[model samples]
Target: MIERRLFEFHFANGDKNGVYHAVYAYRNPDGGFGHGMEPDTASPESQPLFSIMALETLDEVGYLTKEIILNDFMPYFQSVTTEKGGIPWMFRPKSDYPCEGHFKTVKEWAALSTTAPLLGILEKYEIDIPWMKKAEQFVWSEFERIKDKHVFCYLCVPRWLTFLKYTKNQDKAEETINNLKKWILVDGIVCKDKADEGWGLYGKPHSLNYATSPESILHSLFNKETITSDLKELVNKQKDDGRWDTWYGISEGTKLEWAGIQTLWALKVLNNYGEIEK
Candidate 1:
């Protein structure tokens, strides 16, 4: 679809300005992203996870400027961060912003889902804020506490892996990798529905449930052969409208945002594998 073309153009032309603007359009005044960049959290208020998405999107397009990080982004994140140095997944919503599901502001806790990548992002820029140092300690402590792979928090594995990989924390990295291998490789990705998961709206967590092939980020942990079937399934599951679908329980607007992100991720994997021409 048009989003695919935009994604293709993003990588092919080496122009990130358009992509940056598209993503930036969702940025809240607080310097964090909102207005449904994450789709699941439609709250216009600054949410930590959506902020991570914003930074990652900027990083992906090479538009992660110091201005964005130092002046605009960090302040907002810093303000919302808890005393323990961990960021809650979401915060209180703006009066006009409608939130649902996991998007609502509840008990705030530093989540691996948010902190790991936020740490990685900070490290990438060499921006050593106080929270960064504290976050490292918190992450390692969390790692020590988590003795096994958590299925409900399965969506967060890659981000934690990325954090470990970036920090070169071999011990935690190996443990996480092994845990993921046991869960996904040995046990298998679990979802509510097994029969019709290929359509994109299935509740079951397949290899492609969150993004592209599992091997995209976890290549060191898994070979192409292991996830090749799922990768191929991604290509086969493309809807006639040119967008790959996702689960339908979320608001349609949120679903569309996720579809855009997931579709771009899928294209990236296919392009990397030479399955699709650039």
Candidate 2:
């Protein structure tokens, strides 16, 4: 099944010989950062900016390589990361170079879930890079110092999952996730009164971005097999694509990246406990 899916993404759209397999839109070699898809795209920035979740999908699909996966992917990734002293949250393809700390905002859902997704991928890829240590330390240190802040909810959730996935520090992982649970109001819902809730590192997703997001931390908990039955409503929200939305917006629609992080989280939760919608 995985193999068939792999061919679909890696070769299905290409010629039978698979001559130009590196058609990833974000990597259009010219695709400016627009809609995560570029047509005749080119920019002076030359940075292949990608969401961490997006990279995970590619690697999980077994398509990442030195050629397609830029050696500078991490550098560009770090350019937006704090450890690299980045002020740019994202880059504009129109610019000559990626802006350090340039992003004006980290979207609500992304604010909560993006880092851990990157951390997981970085941990897996760091074996080859080693230079990513600085960014790792920077994020880890900040995570430890201000953990109690509601905004720290985003960091801790994915960080816990990253550790669970990459490190053998089961105790630490469990502890982090447990502590993060304090902010969740499971029996109720976040309201307009606390709408300014900074659940993510930055404020976001209106109500869904914070400690309250039933879907946000649910995956991390499921990965550890620590919380079962509490995630039915979350899991049932998965799309038919064997993945869940990265962030859903019915008005503008959603950008359901359908990445592996979601799939892994859903699978672990459902497999251990039972499918939700069944």
Candidate 3:
């Protein structure tokens, strides 16, 4: 339903409100999202990661208004934030619906992976609220701590890059980018080769995942030849059934759900690079 609405909005001249209504079904009373909006977790309880998915959807349709952020999302974020002003990847779900084993457990630490992306999304929309200030502090502090570190997770690379992209401090962001560049494709932060297992899977962040659009700051990290090759590979990844496949092993139901979302994402990325026909 969500993918259908998104397809309509993007390709079939459908009303953006349709997308909103479909996504709103996932919203909890707490203003955060759950109920399998993220597909990995069927838990009805609100989660920070699910909220990121919600915010991304809202932003895609230009429905992420300041009012919504303040009245809905901010309150939920405030409620779950850790002492370090960052949210956890997941909280223990109140109701036990089907969820991945990792998400089923409580994540006690404040995670930069989730928090940076949230901050980056807010920064992308240029929306300001008091809660963001604290999040910004936490994200920046983490960035500083990890700048010199050799081992950084692939999942966190794009999230941190997104934060750096829209951050107010261009000088520091650029420096951080330069510092991190040495480790990006070098230290397994990005899967440069297609032969790598789970190369484009959920956990493996790749060059295209980092750059996304041609206009992205991360685009500078890869040369035109590399980008072109990646784009061609991306185009060829489409299956005969008109969907992309996720290498991550999941249930059939979850796989179908992910296929829809992945198809939507592929179209968007292709459109961004002028690969889509009018």
* lDDT digits (tens) for residues 1-278 of candidate 2: 23234444443552322222332434433432233321112233433334443355466555555544455255445445543422232344454432223232323121224455555565565454554455455445545765756533442354345544664445766676676555443423223232232211133322333323335544342333223323444455556866654532222222333244345444544544444333
Top-scoring candidate (lDDT)? 3
- Decide which is better by TM-score, 2 or 3: 3
lDDT of 1 by residue, 173-229 (tens): 777657666655544354423357533343355555433443455554445554576
The TM-score measured for candidate 2 stands at 0.48
lDDT of model 1, residue 7: 74
Q: Which sequence of candidate numbers ranks them by TM-score, best first?
A: 3, 1, 2
**Residue by residue across 228-276, what tens digits does model 3's lDDT show?**
8878888888899999878542588898888887888888878888888
Q: Flag regions of model 3 displaced more than 4 Å.
A: 121-128, 147-155, 195-197
lDDT of 1: 0.66
lDDT (C-alpha) at residue 125 in model 1: 77
Q: Which parts of model 2 have CA positions greater than 4 angstroms off?
A: 1-23, 28-34, 37-49, 65-72, 78-88, 91-116, 125-128, 148-156, 168-174, 185-278
TM-score of each: 0.81, 0.48, 0.88
lDDT of each: 0.66, 0.41, 0.78
lDDT ranking, best first: 3, 1, 2
TM-score, candidate number 3: 0.88
